[model samples]
Target: MTIHQFYQPPLHWQQFEEFAVQLLAEVYDVPTAQQYGRSGQAQHGVDVYGRSRKHGLIAMQCKRLSDRDANNQPYPGGPITREFFFAEAQAIEDFPHAVSIWILVTTARRDTRVQGYAEELNEQWEKNGIDRTATVWSWDDCVSHLNSYPDLRKRYYRDVIQVNSVDDLDQMVLETISMAFNRTAFELPLHIETPDEFLQALQDTQRAVRTGELLDRKSRHVIRKSIGGWRQIHNRDWQAALGKIDKDLRALRAGVEHGLKDGSIRRTSNYLDFADRRKADELEELRSGCVRDLSAVLIEAGLPPI
Candidate 1:
């Protein structure tokens, strides 16, 4: 019964810059994003030089309203205004390297006024023939990204828990497995590469079939559903079959984790021969069978096969 906490990151501006850099790296492939010059240095109005797949080169300035300032003093920074945004955008021209996007990231709550100003600024830049777009990201944007990317959540929020007590386990089995495999880490042709991410994903599907509670990186909540576990499945045979699948799924995750810890499983390599991918390969095979079995269970229960 863990209580969900608000997305309040009590961090200093410098730590926020590092957090932004790491988060950017996670979202972008082979990210070239990094924190720019240190404080009190001539940084050309850029606190972070981030990259984006869609926008190409991204220039970011993190305007964090730190809970405390340097020297451990109480320092809640001032609000971010459109005037400040304009001043920052005006200074980007001094940055030596060209960027495709200019983003002003703030820990401040979102302001529609500033957002609209950024959009208008983009148009002005376009009309002026400038080769960049202006954007604004408030604390809410970071929180949303945290929810969308599990690895980010795990790194930032160590106490995150995923409880799914309301959703139907049968439908959940179909959805959870689909969600797991469809994830960027798992998909692109499923194979275990990231052990931490893999284990985090496995918990959801495992919980769905087993009819128990587990942490989901995407969510933080405790909900009660009509049917909490597999015990609610009316067909005894179907229930028993689901139980069997859960047993194998649990073992599959355990074996992979243990293998990873023992160095028998190497990251980013699925070679079954020398890498000792026995457990991972088993999980792959079981995943395929599990989907087929899931469809069978749904169909047998007089429901449409997913």
Candidate 2:
């Protein structure tokens, strides 16, 4: 639900550099960024040059770091390396003034080893009177900054930040039920409006029910328990209808199991069918009954029906 997952490593390095410059200047509150590197030109390592009022001259090195796969899709870049950081540090020699703050920004996740190396390197630089400091920014750091300023996320990854509609809940419920029933996985739309708001409310309800303690309970168990709790708060007939729906689904599954044991039902890619049309119809009636009850409960719960 968080727009963080959709931050694609841009195939075009220029686009990434531009975005990073804006991101650092606006979102992260870094001031006065100047692009020192050009496409197809040697930059040593520095991509964007900026001055930090507190930290002095800052040299930002942007690295996409992901090797293109056969399909040219960006896969995970593994642990950060000291060699990568050292290369960026070498760029400080080219600058007219001493670079005080060296930042290596990558699409890869941050590694503690890289941080430790940077710290050690900084100490050595201090000993040698270089006055250089170093830091590494990874994908997660970008997410945290973007999350703080949601407008930036909207600007970059708008697809995952679309406004949710009534239909979304219906689809959500349907997909949940499908998963609960052990059906083939359906790719539900991940985009939702105000997902953080919904997640907060969900957490509040969970805390109330769980005595402010978190537990790793099965999702199906949690859902059923929540429905039962809601039923106690509101005396709704649809609550009983939901129970009946569950019973019908279970009975249908039982019937299938028995059929499989006795070799009475033939199973193919689709539904298991009996030799008799009447038997097949009876089986279908149970399925339809469960669906009807589910739709009624969804509507009663103020969710749109599928």
Candidate 3:
């Protein structure tokens, strides 16, 4: 679902830490808790701490190591140093019963160096009569985890992965209209045969104009102006041509604007499952209706009829 695009920076440190705590809580299925080490500051290096029934004490820190300096000068995010993991290892001293610490970062990629350092530190801790381990979750790991929660991604990163905005719908409508005109001008070869075929072709062209799938208000106004101007210049009966198409175009435009007023295309699961069951049939009707005025207007406008 293009989740990786949301791993970019500009997220506040507190927000990042809060999200990390949520992730850790979900992972451990534990009641999340926090502690203050000395005075009012968080204990050791742990920003969030919790205890799991199965895994005992767990600590986590979220590091949004930005690609910009404190002065806002741009730089690389990292190749986080091994010592960073060592510093996080110090947090285990505060939670003497801690089984593991998770260091989450937005800068590094894999961070195997930090993982290796933690493994070595775990071995040393065993010899010194302490038992603790550390693990670093890099940007890739965080994205992979977050992708599992589609609702959470939608809530927090909706702007990052936008779909079906009004502008997008307008583009779709413009392209569809353009394609219809091209087909009317160049396709259909011989004259439509049989009374049924002739009537069906006219219906299709009219339906295409009337369907109103994605033609928004301002875009419809601009398109109508262009078409009206073209008709005025090239056709003697410009009023007749505009009369046949303008009302449908106006309705289509209004429908598109109303559908996209909220700027979100997300649909309820049940609605998506059952909505527009006859979409294919409706589309076929619209496609057939696209050449309704081709014989009269399009040909006179220097675009030969299909």
TM-score of 3: 0.45
Give the per-residue lDDT digits (tens) of candidate 1, residues 40-139: 8888768888666676788788887744332222232236656887888988888888888787877866668878889989989999999888888777
- Evaluate all candidate structures by whole-model CA lDDT and list the values in order: 0.63, 0.56, 0.48
> What's each prediction's TM-score?
0.47, 0.48, 0.45
- Which candidate leads in lDDT? 1
Please report the candidate that would top TM-score against the real structure: 2
Error of 1 at 92 (Å): 0.7
Worst 10 residues of 3 by lDDT: 221-230
Question: By the TM-score metric, which is better: model 2 or model 3?
Answer: 2
Per-residue C-alpha lDDT of model 3 across residues 90-115, encoded as one tens digit per residue: 65576555555455445455556666
Clashing pairs in 1: 162-215, 162-216, 165-225, 166-225
**Candidate ranking (lDDT, best to worst):** 1, 2, 3
Stretches of candidate 2 off by over 4 Å are 1-6, 67-80, 163-306
Provide the lDDT at 138 for model 3. Answer: 69
Better of 1 and 3 by TM-score: 1
Error of 3 at 49 (Å): 1.4
Q: Distance (Å) between predicted and true CA of 119, model 3?
A: 2.4
What CA RMSD would candidate 1 show?
A: 16.6
